[model samples]
Target chain A: MSQCLHQVAGPVWNLGRLNHVAIAVPDLGKAAAFYKDVLGAQVSEAVPLPEHGVSVVFVDLGNTKVELLHPLGKDSPIAGFLQKNKAGGMHHICIEVDNIKAALMDLKNKRIRSLSDEAKIGAHGKPVVFLHPKDCGGVLVELEEA
Target chain B: MSQCLHQVAGPVWNLGRLNHVAIAVPDLGKAAAFYKDVLGAQVSEAVPLPEHGVSVVFVDLGNTKVELLHPLGKDSPIAGFLQKNKAGGMHHICIEVDNIKAALMDLKNKRIRSLSDEAKIGAHGKPVVFLHPKDCGGVLVELEEA
Candidate 1:
């Protein structure tokens, strides 16, 4: 089915590298320790993103990264997710796109819904939009402009 | 804490790249279509691994891959996971390691538990071991030999 679609017309925007995998952790310090001290990965200090309602720590794997997220304020976005997933879990995967607008337009045409109509400035200060998990095989996917 | 640990002694094994983020999907075809057609990713055909009790479709995002897994046999390891995550969800993240034996030994010394005492041949025909989710901040982690 995808072969036929690919043969007809090429993709509007190129899907680049996987930016990072976000993990919402109940204990940010413990999670950071596990990745750094235990796994021997280069881990960054927790940066509080108050506007985003979470504190993030980047676990750099040299190729890609794992973003460790923890609830920051009262309206932390990951708070509810932590409630359901007590110990912490893989929250979302962010993939880079050559053009965010083109990707969103193409996805919308294909009946793929985005969480928002327009791309917003993400943690990296890049234009990003999240796709609806229900339409994305039940996995929360974030598309960031590369 | 990690800085202090690093100052004391170097890690036993090196942590390599982020291998793949595994997603357990209820419908393999739909998930594959979403990645190949909708997202315009280079996706491989579903390969059934009866021994592994799952069918895997690799969505290549250039730098890293997203592994879509579906149960192949009755006693599939992902069966219980899919039952809980009815709409499907992120299952585990596999990270490449330079030495599996040394990594296991080091993790054991740190009181981090693996699912098994010994590493087993994984889907990629490489030595792999799954770390206990409880000890790894509730996220199932697979360490694959690079």
Candidate 2:
């Protein structure tokens, strides 16, 4: 088994709660239309993140949000993921917490690997860190401050 | 882009809402321990589905669930998924709806593909269908009726 256990999201890895799920899509307009028209999620904001080379659309899902990712530049992480996955799909699952730094330190000390090594500004400009799926059983997870 | 749009989720494609995200772990007890003690997720029940060759433990998150999958028989789909996805991880995302047949038909009309032609009894023995990720951008989705 891996040496690290990321229990910082609190006892059961529960910091606050799920914030949103990011899905990588080839077409932002089509994905937006599906969630908005069919599923009834309201579009809160759509922003082009040049730094990440992706355009993001936030679809409000009542208690939470669903982020749709479409590549803006060929070099974007989402774009890279699409190339590797060869099928646009889920990017990562995000969770909200009270304290991100504390959680990161805890995860680090416990030996759980992190993708970023430090918190970065995420959607809504919130501080977030992504934990390696190796320590988390397979699913890529992101922890952020609410 | 391809022509298919909605019908991927079975007949209804009317995925009412996000249902649950399934995670696979090497040790069910240890993993379930992490989610329950840390995440504050209440453990509902541990069910075994011989047909699927897996056992499941659900961690409730309001209306949704975090399904923990552990392979029962060596030939289980979960076992194959684990072999393909080392370190275990999020296996699939489930969506709930009002009607299963209608959802399936809806997806068919959209030309979206399905893993199962009809809804089969799932972990809770509820009617459910797994949608092929090829239809969606990349995420494997499950459609079900509540």
Candidate 3:
């Protein structure tokens, strides 16, 4: 419906600003070693987000990032993804945008459901919104304002 | 024995380069609308890779590419992925690397089974290798060269 309105459609994903794709790994250090020694990506930091129940390591890939996550407990999101997914990998892809709210509204206009109805503060205290995997084709996609 | 070498110790996947990440959709034009018209990503081309048993539209997402695949025939790869995975969508995440041969060698050295022992060319004349879901969790990852 809004596509007819063109730029009037809420906000684009700011596609060009997409930063990194996150993968859920069973062993964070192991994945870090693989991505670093093998892929040569840079590792920035590893902070345990207890509220989320996991330890995360951020690997920088220039314009994008690869987040390797290890579940802290049995009921963690990464654990659920690993059990259903198997060999532990990609959790969600994060795309960077200047305006998170506008971008979220755009996804909504496209009939895509957000994991969070509104943009919320993420790990780094940055505003973020997660698109439902149902709408993203089996991948949890996070939109963060750059 | 060489998990340190190949990295992942459990299985061997003679992955070549990332072939492309396939995104299944009920409507190609609508999906393309979100990826292209909305996100500003380009729809480079659309073609049917009958050998792989799916029709695909390549949506270029800068560093990566989003492939919108429609089932050409019933019970095709796209259809099967949809059937098993259902609503939530990551079909498979492909990784592009050098030396598929050496990669497989490292896998075998670690007693890991592969979906296939070899590589086959597909779509854009690039070689592809698939890892058995049993070994790679539920995800069917494709490996090729960058």
Candidate 4:
């Protein structure tokens, strides 16, 4: 394994609740149908996000939501993922935080890398920033201002 | 983008809550420390599961838990993962369900494959069955009898 004992004081506030689990799917319609027709899940209509270059739909689970993501444009991040993983896969996970700016400062102080320099409006219309997966044990984590 | 329109006659019972998100880590102690000391989260003692060839610790997030897994033996399933990833990564996700047998049968009926034919005792000391990653959009899924 690897070795690292970097220490920093715990979060100034609670890390926050898990907002959603995002899944990258090549075909949005087919994936939505599987959740709806097979699992009997109530899925939302697909919303296109031109800024993020992705289209998304939320699957309601009462306590949480599953965000289905699909590439929207040529330079979409999901497009590269789909090229590598032909079928699709779990993309990233989002967690809600009370203050995005504070969280970003905390992460920066801890020497953590953020994918973006600043938080951008996400699918929920909330400011969100993505943490580098390399720092998160290979799991891409998103912190949404809640 | 793949095509799938498999329809099932809805589930007889609601799928239970998402129990935990499992992450495969190279160093269990270091990973646990990150969540505890960095995130200020409560973490459980590391527990070894000889049968599964892994040692695990649960980081409590109040509403949910993050299960950190490390290789326990040479033949451990996580060993190969660590060899390739070096820094570890998100391995699988477990979802709680009302009945394991019913869920298995439902999956079988849908032509979905399970990793094992029978449920095995998981770290939570509950009967758990793994679903094939290929069938779950490249994400390994575990269904625990709740």
In angstroms, give how far residue A78 of model 4 lies from its true place. 1.9
Candidate 2 positional error at B81, Å: 1.9
lDDT of every predicted structure (CA atoms)? 0.93, 0.73, 0.66, 0.78
Interface RMSD of each: 0.6, 3.1, 5.0, 1.8
What CAPRI grade goes to candidate 3?
acceptable
Pick by DockQ: which candidate is best?
A: 1
Rank candidates by TM-score, best first: 1, 4, 2, 3
User: Going through the candidates in order, what is the number of backbone clashes in each?
Assistant: 0, 26, 20, 0
User: Model 1: what TM-score?
Assistant: 0.93
DockQ score of candidate 1?
Answer: 0.84
lDDT tens digits, residues B29-105, model 3?
66666667655677856687777777788876666666777778756767866676565365666666566666656
- Choose 1 or 2, whichever is better by DockQ: 1
Candidate 2: where are CA atoms >4 Å away?
Answer: A1-14, A33-46, B1-14, B36-46
Query: A1-146 in candidate 3: lDDT tens per residue?
Result: 44759647444445654466567776677667655654445776678898777898887644455567788865886787788755675577676677887777776676789977899887767888888776665567787776
In angstroms, the error of model 4 at B16 is 1.5
**C-alpha displacement of B22 in model 1, angstroms?**
0.3
**lDDT ranking, high to low:** 1, 4, 2, 3
Highest lDDT scorer = 1
Q: Best candidate, TM-score-wise?
A: 1
**Candidate 1 lDDT, tens digit per residue, A26-141?**
98999999999889899999999988999999999988999999999898889999999999999999999999988887787688999999999999999999999999999999
TM-score of 3: 0.75
* Predicted complexes: DockQ each: 0.84, 0.36, 0.25, 0.42
